[model samples]
Target: MTLEATDVSHGYGNETVFDGVSLSVSTGEVVAIIGPSGVGKSTLLRLLALFDAPDRGTISYDGEDVWRQPEGRRLEHRRRIGMVFQDASLFDASVRRNAAYGLRVRQSWPERIRHGFAQLVGEQNGTGDAVEALETVGLADKVDQDADSLSGGEAQRVAFARALAYDPEILLLDEPTSDLDPRNTAVIEDAVLQARDRGIGVVVATHDMHQARRVADRTAVLLGDEILEVDRTERVFDDPRDDRTRQFIDGELIY
Candidate 1:
């Protein structure tokens, strides 16, 4: 599947945050959007996740027009395309609840799994989807533990598991490891790679150059309310055609 953003533009109140932004993500590929602070990296993620709409453009997922869909269908599409935040928000409830929260809330009745392998396949614990989600993030043993008891990295992993449990088609990450220490950041990075292996289109918004080099197949630089450049990860880093990109990579602020 391919996610295409055609001329997507958004703003708040009277200020324009993003305009004329265009990008795409193909299946099994990870695209990293990098930029300076307050440059709409997270805003783009929110727009991608359908948390809000792009006021002037179209976001197409697998050829279907996402923005034109009705609210209920849009909600369904949002689940299929997941979003992870910078804070990695996790509930105080048990790991089971945290992982299964989407399913529980979306379906009204608890989500049911047909077999045990289903859970194990998703890298979860013995509890099925919820546990499997945790296992995917290497949290099988802590499936019954409280979300509050988890460390920063562990909580993020649980939050990621929640997104995975929904069987999302595309995974959107906004500075996924920003809150983690180096060790935990490595852990979450591994989890993300695993998710990609499962054929999901992953889009990560980050300020970390090394992280982009490590996981991104392609990289896009967001600056001056636009996507300055989008290309292969190495190409973007080593041969940035844009002057702004060169300066930004050299530690000069673009905005």
Candidate 2:
């Protein structure tokens, strides 16, 4: 029903990042976490996506604590969530191969069976799903191209396409369009909106307030180990209740 974190706390060694941080995103909603650099935005995204466990607190899906699940169950749970980083690292193989790699690694019985069948038939390039994912990101024609030869924007889109190929229930984006031009950013934003339309809960960690305002239904402002406020995007931008939120919105505070 929803993805949530309650009183989540984490740090490396003696350094504390945040404590008692709670956040949630319901299906079909996009929640943006915005803050200046080194404010634990990426760390929180990692926790939400189950890439890292919190030192304290729980991350739950549909009221069940995922971290407490058995390791196999946890891995299964992670399959329902996909994460896209700012860098969007891609392999040097063809885009189709790179996009389908995740599915191969997370192979369900049917996928394994199908892959075996494909190998038996000498049809190694059954990339229908990957091609469709690329089409979603406006790169259908690039499926057979070498991923390493792509431009920055194209490569990032391919990374997003790869995540989409699995059709995850939740999509965690960490500044996915930070390095793109306006056109490419718009393309990525459209892809995100399309994902939301398909009932995927989206959590975006961004430093760009404008991007948050554009894509987020709600926004959580993170600062120095705390979420100062989380509210509807318009309200958070136009009439924040917290002075710190207002200051951050007004560019008075830098981080």
Candidate 3:
């Protein structure tokens, strides 16, 4: 599967955040969008996730224009994508329940009814997937704990597990580890690699250049209201085609 944003432009009111930004990510690839803060990296991820329509360009899933599709088709596309935002935004529930929330909501009504019945009959609630995901994020021991009681990093890991549990074809991350400590950040980065190994296309929006160099197969620079460069990770860092990209990478340019 592939997600592509072509010449996409987005804005609020009369102020344009970005313009003509084109990017693509394919299954089994990790693409990182790197830029200084407030450069619309998060907004670009939102567009790729199909959460919002581009004002003057196209967002496509496997070559079909996402916003031009019917609502049902658009929804189907959304189901195949998972996104983790900067804020963890976990529910007031157990860690297990929060991790399994996506799969639960995607179930058919009859499936949900049967699941509830099985739970009442002393059967497992089919949360093996959730458990596995929590284990991936090193949270298996916290499965029964209240989500509200977790530290910030733990809650963010729970959010990541929630997205991973349902097996999305495309995963979108918006500064997922910006607030995390080094240990938690490493955990999240490893989970991202595991997702890529499982043939899931991943787009990570991050301002952390070192993290991008460590995890991304390809890196795109978003600056000055456009994607100035997208290339292999090494090339983007060592031999950037754009002077602006070099400036940003060298800590000389910042908005």
Candidate 4:
């Protein structure tokens, strides 16, 4: 499956954030959006996630135009996608609860009832999936810990685990490790790669060049509210077609 945006333009009121930007990602691929601050990387991600509509453009998933679909269809489509915000927002509850929240909320009433019965019998349900995700992110032992009691990195890991537990077909990450230490960053990066290996399309927005280089199969450089370049990761960093891309890569450009 593929997710694509063609000639997308967006803004807040009169302020144009980006325009005529195009990008695509397919299952098992990791695409990194790299740019300086205020370059609209996060905005682009939101648009791709179908959280917002663009002023002028089309976003398609699996060859169907998302904006033209019915609300029910859109909601169903969204359920197959997962997004992790920059702040790694979580509930003021146990790690297991936080991780399972999405899966629980997405359950149909009949499914919920069945799960409830299963729970009463001491059977595994959403919490089982949540714990498995936690294990993937190295938080298995902290399943019962209060989310609020965890460190910043641990909280982010929980947020990631939450997304993974949903078993999304695509994952969108926005500056997930911007404030994390190297060890935490490495953990998240490894998780992302593992997810891709499982055939989930992954889109990551990051200002850290090294992180982008490490994770992305392809990279897109955003500047001036538009995508300046999109190419193989090595080519974008080592032999950019746009001078601005080169300048940004060398730390010689800033907004």
- Candidate with the greatest lDDT versus the true structure: 3
Off by over 4 Å in 1: 106-127
TM-score of 3: 0.96
Give the clashing residue pairs of candidate 2, or none: none
RMSD to truth, every model:
4.4, 1.9, 1.3, 1.7
Worst 10 residues of 3 by lDDT: 116-125
Q: Which ten residues in a row have the lowest lDDT in candidate 4?
A: 119-128
Please list all clashing residue pairs in model 1, or write none if there are none: 123-135, 123-136, 124-131, 124-132, 125-131, 125-132
- Residue-pair clashes per prediction, in order, are 6, 0, 0, 0
Rank candidates by TM-score, best first: 3, 4, 2, 1
Q: How accurate is candidate 1 locally (lDDT)?
A: 0.84
lDDT digits (tens) for residues 115-191 of candidate 4 = 87986796766688889999999999998789999999999999999999989999999999998899999999999
The count of residue-pair clashes in candidate 3 stands at 0
Q: Residue 42's C-alpha lDDT in candidate 4?
A: 93
Query: Whole-model lDDT, candidate 2?
Result: 0.90
lDDT of 4 at 11: 97
Q: Best-fitting candidate, measured by TM-score? A: 3
For model 1, what is the alpha-carbon lDDT of residue 119?
57
Model 3 lDDT tens row, 164-208? 999999999999999999999999999999999999999999999
Model 4 residue runs over 4 Å out of place are: 113-124
* Candidate 4: residue pairs that collide: none
The models' CA-based lDDT, in order, is: 0.84, 0.90, 0.94, 0.93
| Ranking 1 against 4 by TM-score, winner | 4
